[model samples]
Structure formats: C-alpha cells, structure tokens
Target chain A: MSGGLTLVVALPLLAALILILLSRLERRKGAIAGPGFFQRNGVAVGLYLAVAVGFWAFFIIVLPQLAMVDLSFRPKLPPSQMGGPKDIFTLENYRYFLFGSTTSTANWNWLHIKAFFLSIGVSILITLLNLAICYPLAFHMAQSAPVARLRVLLLLLIIPYWVNEILRAFAFRVLLSSGGVVNKLLMGGGLLDAPIDFLGNDVGLYMGLSYAYLLMMIFPLYNAIESLDRNQIEAARDLGAPWWHIHAFVVMPHAKPGIASGCTLVFMLSAGALAAPLVLGGPRTLWFTPIVYDRFYQAFNWPQGAAYALILLFACIVFVLAVLRMFRLSLGEIAR
Target chain B: MAAAVELEGVNVTFGDFVAVRDANLTIEPGEFFSFLGPSGCGKTTLLRTISAFIEPTRGTVRIGGRDMKGIGPNKRPTALIFQNLALFPMMTVAENIGYGLRVRGVPRHERDEKVKNLLIQIALPEHGHKLVSELSGGQRQRVAIARALAVEPSVLLLDEPLSALDLKLRQHMRAELRAIQKRVGITFIYITHDQGEALTMSDRIAVMNAGVIEQVGNGRSVYAEPRTPFVASFVGENNAIRGRITQAANGTATLDTPIGPLTGRNPVGLPAGDEALIFVRPEALKLGGDPPSGFEGEALDVTYEGSITHVTMRVRTGQKITLSLGGGAAGILPQPGDMLKVGFEPQDGLLLARPERS
Candidate 1:
C-alpha cells in the first residue's frame, strides 16, 4: 500500500522535472544539436555524467523525501507489529499537530501552533533585516566603490564565512551574553547602566540568523545591480532626480529579481535553521524546528516529526510562491 | 529660459592627470555650441564640468550669470543625454520621458500630458506604452532625447548620443536634434568626436587637443581658417607636409621641403628656421595644374568613390600625396604607375608650427 502511494506522488514530480529539462534543452537545441554533449565529450563520459546525476537525484534527494512523505501518513507501530493489522495509514499524526491527542486535557496544541507561526514571522523579519543591510553594501560595492576598496570589502565579507556556522553562532552567544564583550564595552562607555538582555529577548537569535545568511543576500543583489548601466543612474541625476529618488525609482526596480532571490534564500534558510537557534535562542523563545526536532529524536515520534517537517516545507513553498507573485518575477529570472 | 554659460579659466584634474585645462569660453544664450575632438581629448570632461557633474579644479562656471560652484547635477539647470541613451529599461516610454517631472512631484495627469506631447515632438507618439527594450535603436534614441528635454533645462548637454546608430540613422538624428535645439531655443552644448557631426549641427565648434581648446570658431571659419596645426589636421582630412620655414613675410610663409619650397598662408606667424607643417585639403590639390606649388608623382592607387575619384601618388622623395578629382573632371582616370601632377594654390594651403607631439 505504501509503495502504491509513493508511486502516485513520485510520478507527477518526475514528470515536472522532465518537462523543465526538456523545455530548457529545446530552447538550446540549435547549439546542442550542432556538437551535442555526447558527441563533444565522448559517449562514455556523457553516460557516466548522466548516471552520476541520476543516482544523486533519485537516491540522495528524491527517495529520501519520498520515504519521509510515506512515513508521515502511517501509524507509529512497534517494530514487531510493523505492517500488521494495527499498522495502517492515518491522519492522527497531522491532527496531533493542530489538536492534542484524544487523551490530552487541552482542546488544541496552542504552544506548538504559536511556535510555528512565530517562527515564520521571525524568519520574515530576519529576511527584511538582511535586505536592509545588504542592499546598500551591495550597491556600494557594485557601483561606487573603487576596485581596491571593493576587493577589500569582498575579502572582509567572505573571511568571516570561512568559520563553521555553529562556531559562528556560539561566538554570537558569547558576544550577546550578559558578561560578554559587548555588555562590558557598553557599561564601560557609560552607554548602559546594566547589561541589556540581548539573549533573553531573542535579539541574539535574530542577529545570528541575519549574519549567517548575509552573503546569500549580498551576492545576488551585487550581481544584479552590477549589470545595470552606470549611465542610467547618471541620467537620473542629470534629469534632476535626487539621490534617494534615483534609487527608489531606478535602482530598486532594476534589482527586483535579485531581491526576490535573496529574500527567498534568506527566508527559507532562516526558517529551517537549527544551529543558530540552538546556540543563540533564549529560554523563552520556542521555535517550530526545535519542536520538530524533539519529536524526531527526544520523543522518538518519527511519524509526527515527518508530518511537521512536511508542513513546514509546504509553508515555505507557499512563501516562495507569494514572493514571486508580489515581485512579479518568474523562477527563471531569479535563477539567472 | 535660455542662459549664457561662461567658463573662466576652468581646469579639471584627476590627481596628477589633467583632464581639462584652462578652458575659457562663453556660450551665448540659445546658441548651439559643440566641443569637437578625438577620443581622450577632454571634450567630455569639459561638458561634464559645464553640466556640474565635475567641479572645475580652478575656475568659475557661471550659468545665467550665477556662480555654480557647489551645485549638484540635479540642482543645475542643465540636462545631459548620455552616449548610450541610458533609457530606463524597466519603465515604459512615457514613464521614461516623464521621469524628471515625476521627480519634481508633478501631478499625474499633467505629467502624462507633457510626456504625450514630447512623444509627438520626437515622432514616437505610438511608442509611449511600450517598454524601452521593445523600441528600435532609433526610437530609443528619440526617447532619450525626449527624456532630457522633458525637464525643460536651460542648457542641454549631449555626449555623442547618436554614435550607436548606423550612418543613415545618425544623419537623420543630426537634423532631428538640431531642429529640436532650434525649436526649443536653449543653449545646446554638444560633445562629439565626429567632425562631421560637429560641423553640420553646431553653430560654433571648439576643437580640443590633449587638454587644450586649440580653436573656437564657426564651422566655416574653423575649417577654412584653423588657428593651430592640431585643429587643421583634426578638423578634416589634409595632406601634411613637414618642413622648416625658410621665409615668413606678411601673412604667408615659404616652407623648404624634401620635394621643393612650398609657400602657404602663415596664420600663426611662424618665424624663419622654425619647424612647421603645411596642410592642404585633398580637394584643394588639382590635377595637371602648372602652379608654382606643384609636385609630380607616380600614381600608386586610384579609388573611385562615385562622385569623386581619389588618386594616391608617391612623389620622387617617397612621400604620398592624395589629389581628389571631381566626378566630371576626371574623364580620363589615372591608373597605377601613371605620372600625375598635383598642385594647390598658395592661399588654399595653411602653415602652422608643428605640434609638440603627433
């Protein structure tokens, strides 16, 4: 029965992937048909590449996700009684996410639902914050900065990313703690009478998540803005547009695709983030992923965890679609 | 709102490299002026200084008799059309044309009306609804011009705006741009490396070399009476004879050359024994003339260009001299290796001190 269900879900996904590939190939048919991949790189080498990509896509990505989807719809039965009379397909796991189990006293799982929504809301805030920080920096690097200054700025931005993500998160924790260097400086400088509760209010988490994915936002914005003609900005200025007006009317409109791609990347990554939340989240902060994490490992509720994971994945897909619609951008444009 | 532009000892330098130096000129109100030079000759820099994009390193830029030292480009009453047109690709043609008004907080209906009128003026009435990318090259050029003119600036600065078009379209735009300038009656400061573009469109042309404005005069005067050797060679095609001045009297000088002593008008009053170059246009040199200033050479190449035939000949001293024959005058064309006599009247040639560097 699970095998049948897997096939039903997998076939459409396979068809969609094939259609995308075919359309892309058809668009480049003239160039491809002239020399062709197999002809240019020997047939043996082409086959090897094809087989390797097929193996990675099916086994590493598609099969694992399919297995999780299949698991989410089934009951969590004992190993000895697996696939037996009591082990059947059900929605109890997903229902437990919205309303507590029948035995629970509460009518709804308000804590978990609140956490889920809060996680999404906070991720959005982080994405906006990243955009605000990256846009000007990217614009400066791409348009106004000298080549030497741009090189130095690029090196500074990239060097910090060489550290492991978890280590970076931990470093943020150290910096944001009550007795951290930040608080010490604030106190010594007479800017604060006491250390601010950066970690207790989730400020550290937001800062950590924003810093973690900054490069994701900057590079795309820089790439898009760099392709814009410098004369467009000059023309605007020559036409009596002030600096901010020029950016609002000309530069921002041109960077829409970059903004869309950057927002999607930062939002998706911030929503699914584990290391940053685990290290920098305050005791009061309850993120959705931690709940999903507890179900999978601590509580050993694999079915419920898979169901929650799928729900989060669905929400992310909806967010991506909403962003695309809002920006009036196609996936192909963002891909560029 | 036409205004006179005065640049007094304007100098612009980037660190040690001087882009434009000691430029002093007055552009009369509503005059169509042009800065003509080859690439890297500081014409664009001078235009930028006048437009307030670059502040002159040491001078006063007075627009309408007001000192415009620290004003930004937006604050200045000048509009610039970039070389590439620089139309906003994301905006419709109407929006691109009306962007200046929009920036100034003009009402929507009024801005739309103005944009519509501009579109009609540029002969792009139907293209207002289309994106900039959807228009053809010539349409985009017109849209850029309309965008600049929409601001109704006192001065319009153009930086080789027609360079991207083909020959046919460039010629057409030249007339269209000149008509627009005349109709508006504003100070038009045009910058171009194409001598034809400058000569055909501008009321007066300032020829620049390196960082110096060598000569400023009307097209006829600049071409017929160039004050410097750079202007003489740069303004038109000329056969340059390098020699030493042997005699300087009155307004003419005799140059002792490899072939013979050639005499021409000395506008610069070069003294005897000074190195000099005499330039004579190809059309000035006639065929089979028994003039005192004449040379006999073997024809090396003959190119028939419909209305005119150019005969390239090598003199005995191995110097090449080109003489052009009018369409009907060259009934019997000279072939390769045929001996030809090329001559030009003394008054038709110009002699000036040789430039420090070629």
Candidate 2:
C-alpha cells in the first residue's frame, strides 16, 4: 500500500502494544492492586493481543483496507497493455473524482462531488428520521411494556428482517410501484389525481434504506433507555418538571451513548447502502455507491471504484466522530 | 408556608392487591411526620398518595384544606425525595438543586441565587459544581433533600432517603434532616422502615402493618403506650406473654398467665376471659432488683453494646425476655445459665387484646 495507509494501520497497533507494555510493567512493579488483565483471565496478555492483532486488527480490518488502498493508488491499465506505464502507482483516480479531469475545455463537472455530498446528506437525514421515529417506540417498549409483550413486539419487529435485505428492498419497490397498493389506496381515497412515481424519486430510496436498518437504531435505544432508573423520571416529576422537560433534561441525556451509537450505525449503513438504491432508485437518483459500482463493474475501472469506496469509508468515520463530539460522548460510552 | 395534609379514608389498590387501605390521618402544618413500617406495609404507598404520584382509590387527599384529586405530581404542592435519593447524576449539585426552579421558568440569576443558598443549606456549597455521583452517600442524601426543598413546596416527602447510607451517616443525617425541616418550616412527611429513625426525627409517627395504620402518635406515646399489639411488637423490641384477662377494671387489667397472674395497665380494656398479650420494653425491665413482682429465669445470652448490656433470659414458661440494662450492670454481668430475676413496674407493661391472626 501507500505510506499513509501503512501509517494508519500501524498507529493503532503501536498504541495497543504500548498499553500492553505499560500495564505489564505496572503489574511487575506491583504499582496497581489487581492482577494484570491477562493474568486475571488466566492467559498471557500477549495471547489476547495476538488474537486482537492477528484476527481483528490485521486480518479482518487492516489487510482488506490495505489491499483497497493499494488498488486505489494504482492507475487503470487496458487488457492489451496490462503491465504498461499506465499501471504505475498514481493519484490520478482520486484526482479525477475529487477535482474532475480536464477535458477538451477544462470545465468542472461537479457530478461526483455532488453525489458524495447528497448521499451523506441523505444518510444523515435518514439517521435523524430513524431517531425521531424510534426513540418513543423504544422507550415504550423498554420501560412500559410487560416482559412478554416486549418480547412479542421485538419478535414482530425482527421477523421481517429474517428475509434477505435485497429481497426486502425489492418488496419495497413492488409496494411503492405506480400501480401498487400504496398508490392504489391513495387514488382510491381521492388523494391523488394520478399515481405518483415513488421509485423514480429520492423518497422511495430513503424510506427503503431507513426501513432496512430500523432495528439497528431501535435495539441500542431500547438497551440504553431500559437501563435508566425509572426513579429518575419520578424524581424529576416530583421536582415539578413537566413531561417535555423530563424527557429533554433527564431521559435524553441518559440515553446519549445509545443515541450516538444508533445514529452512527444508521448513518454508516445507509451511506454505504447499495441494494435499496439499486432496486428502488431511478435516473433522478445519483447515489455515490452506484457511481462506485459503475466504475468497477460497467466501466472496468477498479482503481477509481476503490478510491470512491475509500472516500466513503473515511466520510463514515468522520460522521461517527462528529456525532460523538456533538453528543459529548466518548468511545468508551458507545462501546458499552 | 407549610400546609396541613389530611388523608380521609384513603385506599390504594393495584388490581387484586390492596397496597394502602383506609389510611386516615392528619399531618399538622410544619410537622415532621413519618410513616414507619416494614417493606410492603403501605408506608411508601401512603407517601406516594400524598405526593400525588399514586391517586387514592377511594376518599380524598386534602392539602391546606384544598382537595388534591386529579392533580399530577408536578402540579401538586409537594416534592418527594426518593429512596435512592434519585439525584440527577448528569447534573451538577447546583443544577440538581435548581431543577425545580428551572422547570418553573425562574430566571437564571434568580435560579443561581436560590441554588447557591440551598448549597449552603445542604452544607455542600463548594461541591455545587460537582456531579451527584461525585458526592458521598451523606452528601447525596443532603443534596436530594435540598433539591426537594428548592421548589418551595408546602409539603416535602422523603421515602427512606437515608436508608442507603452507612449506620453512622444515617444517624447523622437524621439530625440534619430534622434541622432542615425546622429551618424550612414545611410539613415534612418522611417514610422509613427504621423505627429508630422515625422515633428520633418525627414529631409524630404512623406505624403501618399489612396495608393498615396500626397506630398513630408521637414517638414517646407509640413506644410507651402502643394501642395495638402490632405497634408494640414492630416499633421496638418487646417481650410478650400470652394470657387471658381474668379481671378488667377502670384502666388496669389483671391477666391470668402461665407464669402466674400478672397485672398491667390495659388501654384496650378487653372483657374478662378475652385473649390478651402483655408487652414490656427491654429498658423498662430491670434485673437484680427488688420489685412489686418478679420472674425467675436463666440467662441464655448476654451481649454488651456500648452503653447498655443486653441480657437474654429464658423464663419458667420458656419465654425469651431481653433486658437492656445501663452500663452499671457491667460489674454484674450475668453469664449463661445464671439465675436471673427480672421484673417491671405494672405501669411499664402494657396489656392489649390480640386481634385474631388471619
């Protein structure tokens, strides 16, 4: 890969090594009371570090990312001149996507950048909509419902997802089709003069993406709100706080970690989503993932597709950081 | 600004179970009243009824002579300190204390000023900026109390607010709570299963048992003249002897007992031949003393606690009686199997008709 990719992969591993060494030193010096983590777990810290480093940090994450970074930095070569100068390492693909290449008359296309931003925006919008829809539903499920009822509701919510995601997207396409039940009902109710083209617009894709990941948002919120002490709400009420104030001041603050995590999951998943957009989107929709797919499969440009995927990955990380910062939550809290 | 809280025939039922039944009591204005009972005895339910958290199934709850029916907890003129204190962990001490003011739309400057004064009142002025989690158990207890008081409610309700503290801190906070109540001069209705706490802090106490208020009186009255056998047994350690009332007169009844006839003052005045039980406090019973009447027993155990020596003895009737004697009894410590003579004045023992056990 490139030097930047190498550094990115090495940095976290180095930090983990430093932590392990420091903790080991502290144990030998008896500076801390308890046994070191590895000793307490009855295994050497190195073994645990090996499992984390070999299985997770390297093989699962860094290796695949490094391969992609390598592919992204290379230039596209034709089949006839497979090992030609065009195959050399270059930033041409990234440059093309970010600033658009000079044509016969060097004009800014702005298509790729606009698509990138639009997808990010739609992802954020979906995240927010899911939050607004799920918070109350989750709170009711976790706090008010009896155990058996909660289980039944959770089962009902999850049973739909047992079907494949692609199949689910196709189901949405059928449901939102011009001659489908939704349009038929609207027309039957005299709410529409003509059947609207749902799949030909942004609305169908956004709705499908949100529905695909709705459980990802609800479970975290349910787990967090469930753990909150009900007495806090009662105490707030006893202190003269109204319903809105109680939720604003007490409930939301206590659920920050869950909110952060749920938003992160939904944002990341929706931003990188391909199946829903593929099934439900029309010419009007220009999702970033479709562009990446066109580059790799249709146009036969692996380097450019890799670059696009890398950019989307980095954007997802930035979004997660922004969410954590906005909520004043730490990674440790989200990890819980 | 204190208000009298009166519950007239208040009853709380959850589905098929009755939590608080026919609770009738009047808490005088500015009075430090307590509901003392074991777990699930409806003390907390009664407190919640007054706080408007739980509406009574029957009758009316009146605060300051105004009916509080249909009033939500927030709209009611009462604040409750939960058992866990329930201080907002996310908020600073000042913010927790001032939450009520903020909810009432008080200006920031006014809220800050009131929060500052409450911090001093709670003796945590420097810790106002610290989160509730940062405070010690006693500090959290004080903060919860200050938070409840900040709203300037006519009634302050506390539900075992000191139960989480250690023994020393719980004892200390008892005096602190009573002092704060005096300073605020608001009707403080505290709930606790700890009888010692109720006896130490309350102006009057209502001892509840099985969804019923067995007795309501001041600490001294409840301890010295319990009207019911439940009150006499639950309030403190009491030695009881089952007997039949052979002779009933004026206010005293002579009970025919297993260990011979015993005479004591009877407030219930059960007729002759009615089943009765006589109760005597450990402190009221004396050992190694000449008295009007005495019993012979063998000392089974002797425990020395700081200021008192507790002697557990087995009487001729196989009844276990405990005697709490002053430190002076240290010199005359009764060993196991030692012959012991213990007796009490007739007025010290109370005779009550035992209600048939369900």
Candidate 3:
C-alpha cells in the first residue's frame, strides 16, 4: 500500500492509544470535587470510542462498496484461474473512472451536481404539495368530525404505506403505461389522440416519485395542524377579524414549528431516495443515484462508487447541518 | 326601547343530542349577566349561540333590537374571551390588545395610542411589550379583558376566563372583572360553571341545568329564594329535608317528614298533597342551648373550618341537619354525636314543588 493509505489507517489507531493511556493516567489521579476521576476518565474514553465506532460505522455500513471489495476480491487486477496474488496499490480503476481509460471506457465519474439540484427541486415541490393538500383537510376535519372518524381517515392514509415500496411503484407503472386504464380513459374522452408516453419517461418518473414520498411530508403537516389550539381561531372570529386575518395571525404562527420540522424531514428523505428513482425513472430521467449503481454493478468500479457514495452522504449531511443552523435546532431536537 | 341582549326561545342542538333547549332570557343594557351551571349543562352553548359561533336551531338572537340573522361573528359588534383566555402567546401584550384595531385598518399611531391606554386601564402598564407567556396569571387575565375591551363592543362575552388561574388570583380577577365591566359600561354576558364567580360578579344570574334555565334573578334573590331544586342544590350548601306536604297556606307550609311535622316557608307552584324538599342553608340553621324559642334538635357532628364551625345533628325523629355556627360565639364548640337543640325559622327553608330525585 502507498504511504498515504498506510497513514490513513494508522492515525485513528494512534489517537485511540493516546485516549486509553490518558484514561489510565486520570484514574490514578483519584477523585475530585466534581465527578469521580475514574468516571470522568471513562467519559473521555467513551467519547474516543464513539469516534472510533462512528468511523467504522461509516467505513462498513455507509461506504459498503469499497469495504466489500477490499475484504473479498483481488484489489489490483484479474485473478488467475483458482485465485492468485494481486498487487495492492494499483491506481488502474480510479484512472478508469476519472479519465475513462480505453480498458473501461463506459465508466462515468460521479459529478453529483445534477442529482443534488434535482433532489432540491423535488423536496420543495413535495413540501408545497403537502401543505396545500393537508392544510384545508386537516383544519376542517379537526373541529367538525368525531375523534373516531379522524382516526379512521388517518389510518387509511397510513395503511397504503404498509405495502412494499416496489409494489407501489409497480402499481404506478401500471397506471402510467400506454394501455393502462388512466391513458385509455383520457384517450376515449378525446383528451388525447393517442395514449401518451408515461412510463419509461420523465412524466412517469415524477408521478411515481411523488407518490412514494408524499406520505412523509403529509404526516408531519397533519400532526402540526391537529395540535393547533382551536379556541384561538374562535377568539379571532370573536375579535371581528376576518377569516384570512385569523389564519395569518393566530393559526399559522402557532403551527410554524410543526411546519419547520415536517419540511426538514421530508426534504432529507426525498433527497436520499433510491428505490423510486432506480425503478420508475427512465433512461432520460438520470438522477445521482443510478450513477452510483452503474459504477458499482456494471463498471466493476468499487473505489469510485465509494467516493461517489461518500459525496452524496456528505451533501445530505451538509444540507441537514445548514437547516439546523438556520433554525437553531440539532438532530436531538428534531427526533420524532 | 328593548333590552340590550335578548334570546327568544333559543335552542342549540348537537347532532342527535340537544345541548340547549328552548331558553328565554333578556339582559338590559349595561347589565352583568351570567349563565351558571355544572359542566355540559349548556351554559357554554348558550354563550356561543349569542356569539354567533353556534347558531340557534330554533330562536332568534336580538342585540339592541336588531335581529342577528345572516350575521357572523366578524360582523357582530361583540367579543368573547374564551375559557382558556385564548391570548395569543406568539404576540406581545400590546400587539394582542391592538389586534382588533389592527384588523380594522386603523392607522399604526392610533392603534398604538389605544393599546397604551388599554394597558394602563388593565393596570399592566409596564407589561405592554412582554410576551403573553412572560406575564403572570393575573396579568394574563387582565390582558384578556383589555383585549376584549379594545374592540369597543356593545356587549362583551366572557367564557370562564378566570378558570385557568390559581384560587387567589381567581378571586382577585373576579373583583377586577366586575370593576372593568362597570368601568366600560358595556353589557357583559359571562359563562361559568362556578356559582361563586357568578354570584359575586353578575348583576343578574341565570341558573341553567340540562339545557333549561332553572331561574334568573338578582344574586341575593337567587341565593335567598331559589325557585327550583336544581338551583337550590347548585347555588350553595343547603340541607334538603325531604318530606310530604300536609297543608299549604299564606306562603307557609306544613310537611310530615322523617323529623316529624315540620313547618317551613312555602315556594310558589307547590300545592297541598305534593311531595317537596325544603332547602335550608347551613348558616341559617342555629345550634345552641334550647334552640332560641320554638325548635329542637341534637348535634351529631361538628366540623370547624377556621371562622365558622359546621355542626351536623339530628332533629326529633332521626333527620340529620347541618348548621353553621360562628367561631367567636360565646359558647362551647359542639362535637360529633352530641345531642343538642336546633332551630331554623319557617322563613329559612324555601320549599321546592318538585324536589330533585337524587
């Protein structure tokens, strides 16, 4: 291995060793007025172990491509018949991904900007649709209906989500297909001269993707609207303010926190989504996810996929961090 | 020419259940009227019907002699302070108080000036810019009144606005609320399940039960002379002596009860040969040596509550009666199971024509 690779593995180990030594030294110093010296040392050691655990968790779970290939396959070249020794520090595949070498010209180095921008648009659209659809329904339903009826409506919305995501996408595929009932009805009504192109196109991809992620957006918004105090609305009316004023002043402001949290959750989920795009998206509707898939499955490019995957993960982390900073929140505050 | 607020045969129904039955009531201008009852007794529904949140199913609400049909809450010159006070926690005190004016397209300077006056009127002068959450319970209560008053409504409706406060704060607010009502000189229709708040604050009290108005009168009249069993039992602590009427004449009645023949003041609509329960307040029943002049009973139990001692005892034929004795009385404080003489004059017990079954 190259010296840089060797040091990449050694630095964290050195830090762990130092932490263990410091913990032992602190234990020998005895207790203090605050926490027990052993307890404080244990806490410091625990923080170090957490960092170690977190690094490996990313190494093993998040970046599974390089982790899998490193443990099983030959690193540098094609194996001899049964199995053979392979060189460790070869830069051949990385060159293939980045430069598109003649040996493997199909490799696409992951750019990630296209997918990142697409996800942002998709998250915004989903948030708007959820707010529009749920605001009126939840507000009217909260006061007028009995609690039992409200529960039933909520349960019905949740039940459709219990079906496997693949099944749901397949169902949408059937709806968007040319010979399907949706297109047939429209064609029969003279709305279209012929069945429209849907599945295997961007239209079908948008339809399927929205259907998959809408539930995540709707649930948080509905909960927020339901928790709003009903009497405040009545007070606004009694105060002689019109309907719009009442909503703008009292109802909307009270539910603002809920809207913030719901938007954050829906935005993250829509951005990271893989299954809907992989299945429903046509060749024309290229997103960042399928790029990661092709690099891993078809090109036999493990290192490049790892780099690409880490890029996507880092983008998501940054996006969440930015939202938290703007709203003065932490992941701890946003937990369900 | 007419009363300030009038409900002519108002009835409110919720699906299959009738929350308020045909109820007739009228309040003159500048009157502090209260709808008082236990919870789910339809006092709140009546308030909402008047406020136009819930339209009356079978009656017309007339405010200042105008039929309130096709009039929504926003069109009406009325304001209701909700049971929770419903103060906007997101807004500051001055902003909340100025909301009505702000909604009315009043200019910024004028609205601010009006809010300043209202803050001073509520005695929360320095708290004009504080958030609603930062204010104390008593301060919030006054802020609610100020907000309602800022609208300059013909009638102000308050629905248990003091219920959220502590006991001491609630008492202080009771006085403050009445003072505000008087100072504003606007008709106030208050809804509360608390009889104490109603009796203490209202110029006239409307006692309601099971969607029906049991009685409506001045506080002292309602307290001293309750018209029905529900009103007597609800208004104050009373000893209901169950009996069968033997005879009735000249606003006085003779009844044969478990305590032998009992003579008591008569209630209207009670004819002879009817079963009625007599309501005598605990304070009105006297317990001492020889029962003053013409009555007798034995002291069964004595419960001292600081200033007044509550003595429970049995009359001649094993009927228990509770009487309140002042603490400073120059006599021995009675205890449980002590036989003593007790007397309540015929005027004290208000005979009910139809005594409550329970």
Question: Against the true two-chain complex, what DockQ does each candidate achieve?
Answer: 0.84, 0.81, 0.66
For candidate 3, give the DockQ: 0.66
* Candidate 1 residue-wise lDDT, A205-252, digit = tens: 999999999999999999999998999999999888999999888998
- Each model's total of backbone clashes: 0, 0, 6
Indicate whether candidate 2 or candidate 3 has the larger TM-score: 2
CAPRI-style class, candidate 2: high
After TM-score superposition, the amount by which residue B333's alpha carbon in candidate 2 deviates from its true location, in angstroms, is: 4.0
Clashing pairs in 1: none
Candidate 2 lDDT at B92 equals 93
RMSD per candidate (Å) reads 3.1, 3.4, 6.3
lDDT of 2 at A207: 87
lDDT of 1 by residue, B1-358 (tens): 4248998999999999999989999899889999999999999999889888888999999999889999999989999999998899999999999999999999999999999999999988888999999999999998988999899998899999999999999999899899998999988999999999999999999999989999999999999999887888889888899999999999999999887888899987889999999999999988885876887899999999989998899998898888888986668889999998778899988898887875
Residue-level lDDT tens digits of model 2 in A1-336: 999888766776775676678777887888888655776775666667744664466566866899899999988877877677667888888888867865624455488988999999989999999999999999999778999999899999999999999999888888889998899999999999899998887667988998999999999999999989999999998888899999899999998899889999999999999998888777787899999999999989998899999999999998899879888888999978
lDDT of 2: 0.88
Please report, as a residue range, the 10-residue window in candidate 2 chain A with the lowest summed lDDT: A101-110
lDDT of 2 at A320: 93
Residue A280 error, candidate 1, Å: 1.4
- Candidate 3 docking category? medium
* Candidate 3 residue pairs in backbone clash: B297-B340, B297-B342, B298-B340, B299-B340, B300-B313, B300-B337
- Error in Å for residue B177 of model 2: 1.1
Candidate lDDT scores, in order, read 0.90, 0.88, 0.77
